[model samples]
Target: MKDEKTREAYWRKNLSYLAILLSIWFIVSYLCGIVFVDQLNTIRMGGFKLGFWFAQQGSIYVFIVLIFVYVRLMNKLDKEFNVNED
Candidate 1:
C-alpha cells in the first residue's frame, strides 16, 4: 500500500523529468535547427553558421549532456525515495 504509492510517486516524478528533457531536446533539435534556422543562420558560431551547427552538431551534444543530466537527476531522486539500486 504505502510502497505502491511511493513507487507511483517516483514513477510520476521520473516521467515528468523525461517529458521536460524530451521537450528541450525537441525544441533544440527541431525548432532551433529547422523552424528558426534562417534567423539563427544570421549569427555565426565559430566559423560555422549557428543554425547549421545546431542541426549538424550542437543538438547531438546537447542530447548527450541531457542524458547525463537525466541520469544524475534520477540518481538523486532514487536516493531521496530510498529506492536506489545500491
Candidate 2:
C-alpha cells in the first residue's frame, strides 16, 4: 500500500492541476466571449469579428487544446505515481 504522504501528494498534484486548467478554460470561454466581447470585437479574424470567432470557434479550439494538455500531463503524472494503465 502507498504511504499516506505519497497518496496525499499525488491527489494534491492532480487536483491542483485540474483546478488551474479548468480555471483557464472558464476564463477564456466566458471572459473573452461574453464579458470582454466588445473589446474583442474590435479585432477581426478573417471575416469574423474576434468576439464572434471566440464564441463560435476559438473557444472550441481552446477546449480541444485543453483536453490534449490534460491528457498529456495526466499521463505523465500517472506514470510518476505509478498508476498508469497499460
TM-score of each: 0.96, 0.92
Off by over 4 Å in 1: none
lDDT (Cα, tens digit) per residue for candidate 1, span 13-43: 9999999999999999999999999999999
Best by lDDT, which number? 1
Give the TM-score (vs. native) of candidate 1.
Answer: 0.96
Clashes of 2: 0
Q: Which candidate's TM-score is highest?
A: 1
Could you tell me the C-alpha RMSD of candidate 2 in Å? 1.4
- lDDT by residue (32-80, candidate 2, tens digit) is 8898999999999998899988888888899999999999999999899
